[model samples]
Target: MLPVGAGAIGTQARTADSPVMRMLDELNHPATAAHILAERTMLHMLRGHCNSPIAGYADTTPDGRMSLFGMVFKRDGSAFVRSHAWGDPSDPATLGSRVAADLLHQGAMKLIDATRK
Candidate 1:
């Protein structure tokens, strides 16, 4: 079987005041968090859902910059739009937004809309 993509694991607490949550948060790796958050933010900006033909990945470069790559594909896999960008690791959301906007500007929405029908 082919691999669809990578998955992210996260933890939540009933309340923000929980000491266990704080500890877990502290143990979080900044680079990994940035990568995941950046990808998630791109998907969010694109309004991507489980049914949408959207894919995205984010990672940190060896020099510590954050890079995001995103794509929107037609349902039949006949066409697609893609965008990539690199930005500061400390501001991953901006990188995500930038790449998403690039894809949108390139008619990603058309591909996304076609998938719904």
Candidate 2:
């Protein structure tokens, strides 16, 4: 584990050059990879086939208390969570504002992924 938190650092930002818009981008890790892992973990655990828990995380603050989970689930109702840890202790508003926005982006991706099938 990367301490209690190290995922979140720096304020969230937007760049016009962004080719794709995913809030998970608020952190540096690839959301797709993290999501896939979460899905696999969730499915395996739920189905009793999991080798181990697949917990991945990113910093939302730097050492904050709270994690943004990328728990992945499919249209079939199988899923897992990808988590982002907070960088520091923060108010719910700060956590919700920054984290939620990015998660919303991630949720949209999940929908699209479901639709692709």
Which candidate ranks first by lDDT, i.e. highest?
Answer: 1
Worst 10 contiguous positions by lDDT, candidate 2 = 46-55
lDDT of each: 0.80, 0.38
| lDDT (tens digit, per residue) of candidate 1 on 6-111 | 6666777777678887888887777878887788788888877677888888888899888888888888888888888999999988998999899999998888
lDDT for model 1: 0.80
* Poorest 10 consecutive residues by lDDT, candidate 1: 1-10
Off by over 4 Å in 2: 1-64, 77-83, 107-117
Candidate 1, 36: how far from true, in Å?
1.7
Per-residue accuracy of model 2 over 56-90 as CA lDDT, tens digit each: 33323344354444333344546533434343333
Task: Score candidate 2 by TM-score against the native.
Answer: 0.28
RMSD of every candidate to native, in Å, equals 2.7, 14.8
Clashes of each: 0, 19
